[model samples]
Target: MYNTLLLLLIIPTLTSGQPGKCDQTPPQATVLTPSENKGIYTMTIDMKSKNQNIYRPDQTYVLIVTSNDVKRPFKWFMITVEDPEVDNSSYEFDHRSVDVGSLKTLDTNRQSRYSERCYNSVENTDNTDKYRVEIHWVSPKQSDKKQRVRLRAMVAENSEVWYVGENLTIELGKDTTKPLDSPPFPPVDSCNLCSEARYEVIFKGHWSRMSHPRNYPIKPDNNGYSHLVGASHSYKYILWQEGDKASPGLKKLAEQRDISVIEREIINAMSVHNGTRTLIRGKRRDHPYMFEPSHSLFRVDRIHHLFSLVIAMKPSPDWFLGVTRFELCTELGWLESHELPLYPWDAGTMDGISYESATSSTQPVDTVDRVAVGSFDKESPFYQMNLNDLKPFGHLQVRRLDVYPLVGDDCVEGINEHEGSQEQEAGSENVEEVIEEPLIQAIKQDPSLQEDNCALSEWSEWSKCAPDTGYCGMGTQLRSRYRNDRKVYFETYQDQEDFQDGYKSQANMAANCRQKQDGALIESQNCFVDCL
Candidate 1:
């Protein structure tokens, strides 16, 4: 019989917390009697009756269907298998697979009962074992109202599987049918299987005018040419309090880079709706003074959206680069990228005397400090630039692009809208496999094999003179030192024989530091705390 149904489907199917194979007997089925009128619901199953032998072929069958008192939930369910001696059947729901047609809808205000599972097998061809299994239920908001159903059937024969059917309960109340005074509405504690989601907000902008600091301005002047020429971003879902006050449309979009009075008065009065603006087109030495890299796109619905950005570091009077109220849905979910490192804030309303001073600063607004590189000194005009390669000047790639189906109404299709041409074809195939690696062709044929013989580390023992501050007075009692081993030799003839034997040779050390003892291990102790 198909090799006893492939040795009872290769046994080992014991779970309900194990232990079963007929010893704890329970494997039989025959539950008919189930029907409803107006709101449609039906059920039937036989599987050869005669004290329910369960059409053997080394049995294994399970069917669990549920629905209790419905009025607006129970969108669909179906399963049909009219015999000719069946051989296979499968159905599942929620965890997907109801023949993939419709099955993902169960939120009668967060589940009030909905279950499905069917598995039937009869092995090799049809041998007349009499079969029939049909089940269906649909509710267009309870078509004309009336529902109740519950069926549980499980069977597993020798080689194990058993829970044996018949717990069947059915009702289709239009006028009372009884048998369900409770049980079937325990499932509400946030079941958001992705209620609408879409992200994609790339905005990359790196500024440079020989990295800033030459007569600065490229426009907007009274004398001193302020030069950070372009930027404006906006987003809102409100929540910015810290002694609030700053409005006047955020000081005219931070000292005159005007964003239409903060998009009609503070992002349309704290937007939860109308508020969208993102314009970042850098470089301004006058007339689109060219300097590239700038992007923008934003959309977030719920998950407490909030974003704000502003840039302008022109001739200097009102300096800028402020980003407040970030929060792009956290709690481990919606934030794929967020990099901010543009510092220089001084919206104290305007003050200039350098960067070509167009002068203006009656001082007053306060909070000024954060524009460094020794804040332009070497005769000002922004000297030896390279503020850490312009400190990450704003990068915010949020990429989520579609995810809505936890009980669909059809809306969740838009996979990465060409995700920047699939990330520029995966960054040009990872820069052509990192320029054909072999460590970049051995550092382009020995560029001193990119030096790095690595060694430095041998201090250790000297840590007991705490009290640097648990103050009583003068304080300063420190003594600390560590490192008893550090090695690295990327073979190039063992780093040129450990750089010509400057170390590494106790069979190339590192066996507990080959009985320690190397050079440069200074440890000092100079403390003094007497005041009180």
Candidate 2:
């Protein structure tokens, strides 16, 4: 049996001198799911040179699964291709191996699934005690125009530990429309013809003192924020770094709410430096209090995986808050959803002791810093509060909307069809060797190891309104626990927000956290209540 080289990641949009988006060489590039670690392995093509990056439609190519961290070995994995325009499973694997005595599963009704690696036997396993393997893929013929495809792979260390591999992407078919200047990262940038993915940026305000408006500080009557300004760039560039003096663009943006300042910077980076690819902008919200949750949508590609954004506080002394350089991709690919705590920062451009302080103090500090105490007077707000004691002024939530072909223009933002989703079944497999079950004893383990024991860390605090999504959404309360010691579990509580769709969004995603049924302690998490 040939070692199945099962990777087919060509790449996503890239900046000049940056690694391929799907290529694992640059690190932290792709993932099937969002997580802290970018994983140690990724898929790659065994091409002789960079020119072979394009798939010439109908040609058979050899795919390989390689790792960056060779010290970390794995046992099982799942791989597939996603090309919305084509059948995902139609891109078949070259299964010419001769072996059996494996688990039998029903495939697409009567069709059996292809060979899945396990300790089937010494000779039949795809690879054991190894760091890499090779698989084959037969590319489909081009139809009318070229379309992009994503090769997603999932690597697991047993059932409980797995890293989502960075996606391997490549364009299918020949681009005959115009002779391209060059392939991005090699020749030039991929034309911004279509957006590869969509993410919803939810800005949740948490500035209220003691959770009550009647508290000490009065809410500003003219409170609101300017449009959110951000960029999607490679690992090499940063929109604003903490500790360093803010860039001319960022300095102007934070203190003056001038988005054009950063817009020019992003355009220059894309054209001259080749470090950034997309310039992201959102609409301005002008309303009283500004504590209510608001959201905006932006598009992204694989190469430009790191995100940096900044927004201004309308009434403070050059106070602002936003992520510096947040990573958006996981080992498997881009995240489905993510959230972060947001604290206020002092842009160091002006001096003031209160929200209504000097508008033009005109004293610039050496570097940017967080909001800190300038006076010990009790009348001065947040002066006594340590940087840690000062609760987050707001929070940021990112939820993926859609990816490629299906996502390009403005219409794709609020039109996500998450309901009625289903998975496709598999087809028949061709195994040449078969051994009776009685001959090969199945490896057994402790029953406690397999039971779905309730294992978890402490429950996280209930999220503020606009819990999981945009608009007045429900408050989310989540806790990370291992289901059968593997999957992350969550429980979101109520806070009176989005009445129409919030309940629907929660129904299919989380384990309900509620009181136990009378005389039935086991039924605590199984109950459902109407949010109406």
Candidate 3:
């Protein structure tokens, strides 16, 4: 009665181009489960829909569903394996979004196992488990209302796995009101300190030839696992002894542990050869590591001994690749020594030979292959170390330690904090002159001194006088003035043979070479020479 001429208009829900399409159902899909193992595997799913009026065949759709974890605690979903179907027209294809609507409803468990952008390996590969899939309407629709649908399907093995539902009901039925309750998620394994420990498997085998022994790295099998190899050489006794040899009683342990055995010959050359030693000048009179407190400091009287271990690849060593390990023994037990601190240790590819000094202060364990040794000069703090300061078996122990002189005794005050002014004064007064006043003046004029003509040539008398840090060319700077006066020598060559045989004695000379009008040849001959 109140609206005799009233008129009403109703708007229908619209899709991309059509209206009143909210009642349409979406098609189902087929899903496959991961393989049996819990490492890394893949699964596939297929979607199908023929309701052109409700769901367009040309229009693309996304599918997502909840994960089934109660059946397999270790199982995880990998989105990378998804491959959607493309239509005949290159312009159109089916796509899926993982998190929305019914798919979100199914995954209400709230415990997501996937790390953002991080890949996880699936242990199982079989396609027998059920997975959720959702369809999203992405194109611009005529209606303001959004449309989405979801369904669950089991992936068939190998065959064309596809969606299984005739069509998903979009209405808010009793099924929509009651959510499917999923099982609680299991606790993930989280080992903090355990994760820090590096556990590796090594495989050592000939890569190219079988008859000859050689080592090479190979890809892991279907499983993602690799074996590290041990490098053996013939140069050093330690490596030679440990080559291809396992710990004395490790056979049983090897059987129990996850180990990879690479059958290849160690091709390092330094193991099969000997290293040479060299002489280096020290900053102080005594060798750095052996310098006495009362000794004078100068390069002429301090010759540091240095040893070297040169390693080279027989044919050529692969620097970018290859693996090696070290071992150590202690009162507690045997432990795998950490990899040598020499990062990027390589030969042949990097350089044919590698160098290690004896003064390196590195501790020695059971065996050292391709290892180098060296000594420090008097200028090194270790040069003056006493037995008490040198720990023998502790962590600070050095098996092949060496010293090198870096500064002169003139800077002693800067390096040593305990010098007393009173002692300095006393030393200045008591120190006797090694060279006679007349001899010093004569040597200064001639620039050389002969053992026979030396003013002070008696051992007792010379030693009792001020320290005579003899000449560097050919004399024991510390020798008693008369004892083998010319037994010492000097040279810059690093070869061991050059300094071993000893310098030619200058005791027989009649006059100082420096004083002679023409004694250049004699002075040249006095230099230390390499035997070879």
Candidate 4:
């Protein structure tokens, strides 16, 4: 009896001082099968984990299985615990791999392939030192969410195992039935068929005029047509899976072929939060500026409008002849009474307005007389471009195109019209449109009306008539003011030919000029005020 009492005391001491569980953690897992899954592929995995100390044959846990791939890192999720006690009803159990009808095959277990796997495995006898589970089947294809047969295992550790497979589901996607790289473009109709390189160059040539943070690319869902280089609805190009993300194949041909393609986004507009300015690229005249490959969040429908103009000039004998085309893309849904990025009045200044300031009282008229849209020859130096070699990710076939041509003073002819003269006495419009009468008609014409005519040597004596109204009077007024401002500040504008560039400079000038309190020309609070 004394020995037994000594043994009981010794047992308590040994239990308190003995080494505890060495393999208390679960095992790491590795999936070995299913390198690819498109049709009838199978998935298999080998997992190992450990548990020690108290061992109960009835204790159960679950294992979650998952995989990593290139297109998608994780695709499947499968559970290991199949005990009736573990409610598997909450799981997304798709039995597409189950055989039915004549496709059924004889199985010793008579259970569907996917439901055939044993829930748990014991290392030896009724208990297990580690768990290994495997499942096989084909995923369902009809769902829009593309829920695939993914695998992610979790073991309850008998303690943590209950919640391991709960609320775990793998997202699936449709198979790539038609692989890319099959020349997914329409049949060519013209010589050279405008290769992707040429298309990109043309797109660049026309995309540069847009000023962003004000003239951003519109979202496709936005109402109205896009007027910028690549903003139009029909202006999308193809995405040659292997080519640059900005390749012109994805844009419309007319837009991709034009000379310029740049637009602006406004940071602050009225009380509506437009976020910040983003430069959207790849838009064309009369097209919708729907999507910008560079900036994904910018949507056209969220904005009010987009404006674009293209000017083409030719040097004539008397003046520089030019054709200017203006276009606007607007929406009715988002328009409000609040101030907007000024259209032409404020936009044409090219010098004085800050994108942050919305108080400028500039109004856009229907006409813009100073700017013109012009056609260009592909061979012209302005259209000439170099290849961009260092594109990110070894993409973006950067090919430079010619900048738009700038018409000089020699090619410009100012119109002169008499005030309120409606009758066409000597009908000749501006100097650019004036036609010279034949010398023979002047010499042989009736001598009475000869009072209006002069000698062949004095052909300049004949004066042309004026129209009832001035040429786009409102437009002329606005353009004249802008031109006068630039002319008066010639010293301030050495190389400032661009309207937007000039406007930025003007914004700086206004900030520096200040009202003096004591006849002193000291700097005022304009800079600080402007910032505020």
Best by lDDT, which number?
2
For residues 9-31, write the lDDT of model 3, one tens digit per residue: 12221112121111111112123
Model 1: what TM-score? Answer: 0.20
Model 4: per-residue Cα lDDT over 1-532, one tens digit each:
9999999988755343212211111232243222223312222322112221111111111222322223322222224222221234334332322211011112331222231222221111112222323332222213333222233333322322221222332322334332111112222211111111000101111221242222222331331212222221111211111212222222221122322222221111111122111212322122233222110111111121221122111110000111111111112111111211111111121211221122322233111121111102222222111111111110111111111111231232122212121222122123113212111100001113233222222112211221223322211100101111111121111110112211222223223233223222111111111112
Q: Which one wins by TM-score: 1 or 2?
A: 2
Segments of candidate 4 deviating more than 4 angstroms: 1-41, 44-398, 401-509, 513-532
lDDT of 2 by residue, 493-532 (tens): 1211222121222222223333222222111122223355
TM-score, each model?
0.20, 0.38, 0.19, 0.18
Point out where model 2 deviates above 4 Å.
1-196, 209-219, 271-273, 359-364, 373-379, 404-532
Q: Write the per-residue lDDT of candidate 1 for residues 450-502, one digit (tens) a residue.
A: 23333444443333333444433332322222223322221111110001111
Candidate 3 residue 186 C-alpha distance from true site, Å:
48
Specify the poorest-scoring 10-residue window by lDDT in model 3.
Answer: 435-444
Question: Going through the candidates in order, what is the number of backbone clashes in each?
Answer: 11, 25, 74, 97
Candidate closest to the true structure, highest TM-score: 2
lDDT of 4: 0.20
Report how far off residue 102 is in candidate 2 (Å): 67
Query: What local lDDT does model 3 show for residue 416?
Result: 25
lDDT of each: 0.32, 0.46, 0.21, 0.20
